[model samples]
Target: MRGYQEDTPPSSISGDEIAGMDDEEAVFLGYLDEMDELVDDNMEEVTDQEEEDTDMEPPEDLSILVFNKHVGSVFCCDLHPSGKLAVTGGEDDKAFVWSVQTGQIVFECTGHKDSVIFVGFSFDGAYLATADMSGLIKVWKCNLDENQQEPWPIAFEYEAEDLTFGLWHFGARVLICGAVSGDIYVFKIPSGDIKVLQGHNTRVECAKMFKDGVRLVAGYDDGAVKVWDLKTNAVLQQIQANVHDMRVTAIDTHPENNIMASISSDGKVILATSSNGKVVGQLQAENDLETVAFAQDPQLGFFALGTLNGDVGIWDTARQMVRHQCTKSDDESVVGVTKMIWEKDHLITGCLDGAIRVYQGRSGEKVLQLTGHRSEVLDLCFNENENVILTTSDDGTARIYKYEINKDKD
Candidate 1:
């Protein structure tokens, strides 16, 4: 019988030296050698993977034009009806009308006592309105002549009580504004005439003009929704406060029908008729709701909703159910959605993570992500032709991205 070495360890004995040991000891030493080789191979692979990951770069900035003049957070932005210019208001208490083609400042709207909360162009692109949080509203007549170098004249001005939001009529020279005091003011631009619609002592959170251009829908902080007659200054219909149970965040009217959709901060979505204010449908989400938008085409019979939890749900109006849910990647943190709009078959969303995501409206899959802003997106609007998007952010900047249809998705 062969004697075995008692003091030496298997790892210290090499395969060449194992021949002098007992058969059992030699086999154990051989196994140890093989295990050492396997560990070395794994370490090499891991080191190479780490190096590759370290070399990866962040996504490129996709904005075609960046507006960096605002000294503070940009609160609102709009594209001109002719798609030749853009207007943005910010916490800097200033508003700028800049050319889209050259990004040159066409006019600087100043003299606001507080932050400019809203800015937009009129339906015909002849008037531009800028409003501040302290209720200072100024309307400017846009001079489109390329040879004209003078500043646009102030056509109208008014001071209300703590204004919250403003809207422009789609077909007329009417500018509607909502106030914290629950009063909705309608102003006929250039004339400075005003009509006041009283609310039930709750702040008017959001409002929209109907396609007919005669009626308006306003949502309140107490969860009440009212359809008001612009001509009569009377409530045409009302949805009582018990339905939403929270502050209304947004409201949108259908393009070709009497249906209106309103979302509340408590995650309740109410679909009602703009004519009678009758509750036609309702959807409840598990997270707080932030924004909602109806498809541009009425034939699609669906609308998209955004949540504070980074969820996008495309709901079928006829079925009263979610057709598809768009979610973020697993590696991504929760990114709240602040605003959204539908253009043709696409859903464009502005997120708190500072990304503008474009989703395929038919499949609910994200097709493109545009990045540039360093803070939350406050608002967004697209050109009349839907080939460009203008977005404002809390980062004190606004950016424009060219919208190209991804034909591969079709």
Candidate 2:
């Protein structure tokens, strides 16, 4: 596992912090807690997630349909904006779709020969895209109402060695992707045209589109965060990458602020202003974080980070401290977490033990403990429209659960 980099006090910049947008560092000082390992490395990974054998059957506690046919480890799952269709990618070299209500495997799209590390649907839900470890990215258009074999039509396909995937840094639409050669490729959709932004000292880890996709913010393994102009494809701003000499695992943008949050393989969680390239706040974690998510509503004012230590920390980004800590008694580190939007009061988390636990965002109460995957739970998405949860497990399955949600009455 990589280690967290120690930080000096944040850069003192003026006229950048958005007013009434979020709390300042002084306010965050009160929220600091000792458990949040304040070490040198912010993104240190606790442990790497090992692929569970796909041959195992899902545990009965879960309520969704098992994907049932993939031969490799599933890495991620995402639901369409419509909430009826779902998609998953895994180590098995396949990406599958399922009915959110029926638990039936409606589509199993396969072609990539390597592990499918990430998968996503477009903002409008018109397209589905998947990225593999080998840097292969494929786009599929959905037409599930038609024949199953034709559930998705092949749209765009590219390889790392050939065109170099700039797989839409934020979504299938964003114009930034990481090159295997350690460069940032900023390109828009459909045209497949690209502008290669060279300068990262190491491999680019993640990139994001900002405000209507006109600007981009990105982080790399070398520890630098660069803000770029989409129109000109120029480096507008840059933050040095030495504070933490580790891999950047996850990064998220504050919907309303120019602020960006990044977690490293070294275990340091940091916030930087994309507009000016400055750090707003920082938190140290005990283990390397696998995933991190910001709340849809900043007033609920939260973000969740899953650690390799089998723990989940619910942080109040405003307060600058973890308000809640969730840990499995066993050594089951959490791999994925999502903040439920419609139900802003809750969060959904997936762990290596294949357990999908739903918890209250405030009280940290365990709301539901669901089981379905035979192996580890890789990804989770919530469909508030139907009150069901979509999850993909390492057992080669994606399942939907619709358990009742009854509020506790006195």
Candidate 3:
């Protein structure tokens, strides 16, 4: 070791003691210290992957919530941002609410004249919105507090037809919605005001604000991926030319929004950005895709891709490759994937076959299969209460599933 001076012996390396005994040893030791720091920062990650390696099994203890039926197929669902309740939309042309904890039906919202395609919560869990094929979006004032018996009345509404999808900006009170007419509308929550954004040459399949509200991304049937500035509401970039060989079904941003990915009906998954507006990498699952989710933890940078053909591919986004994939039995093609949510080591899956399965994110395996819905389970949400899961299905119902996490699983 090189000696440091207590007072005045601090001359820089010059003579034999400074240079003599161990030049190579000093350089090697410095390199070792640098490596040690890197290891310390990354040790938890290495441990997580190792845990994935040993146990890919879903947890065993899964129980059903309440199941209240709708008249027709339930098309979509959104959990109250509080996770204490759920709102579901369906072919029945109605919306219903359920208690997440007790598995009980609470309210059935009636207003939309046609089938409801999508529903979502405001950032604070105070408001909710649902969209239908008629191009109308209804905003409702909701109270998730279990103390209330009757549901709250409709607070406000926005009208749109040929509607595709709508999502609130990350944790903001504003919403960005898109329609088949190639118009993207941004709605100010609870106020019922709207802005129509125009650019795409065809129907917009999905619209969501990314990078907090700094940027907005929309995918259209023309295979075009467009980015917009949230403030000026201007098009920032556009990348087109057949993203999949078919329709672009869904798109979502990485947690940071610096990168985003889109899925095409022809089985294409693209990783791209707004700056250069090019796909960094791409993957084709077995069949057309439904939804894609990025992991919450940044360093893990994992993603789960759900396909219409019953195939789910888990990706290490940093490595840009499928780390593991699983197909349910041999007969089930993944018709849908709700979202990839992490609970400790598990990534819970909600499938179109009305089955909710959990898998170890590190290795793709069926950990638990929650069977209850008589039809396709279209939407699911996790978090809030970490041990519980919420799902809505085509059987015109919403159900919650609960479980206990054991130390062995962790």
**Per-residue C-alpha lDDT of model 2 across residues 59-153, encoded as one tens digit per residue:** 67547455556666666778877778777877677777777766567877778877777677767676677777787777777774835455567
How do these models rank on TM-score, best leading? 1, 3, 2
lDDT of 1 by residue, 334-400 (tens): 6779999988888989999789888888887778888888778999998746478899999898998
Off by over 4 Å in 3: 1-62, 103-105, 144-151, 328-345, 404-410
Off by over 4 Å in 2: 1-59, 103-105, 147-151, 162-176, 199-201, 327-343, 403-410
Ten residues in sequence with the least summed lDDT for candidate 2: 40-49
Cα lDDT, model 1, residue 368: 80
| Number of clashing pairs per prediction, in order | 0, 35, 10
In model 3, what is the error at residue 335, expressed in angstroms? 8.3
For lDDT, the strongest prediction is 1
lDDT of 3 by residue, 156-190 (tens): 77676677777777667887777778888888877
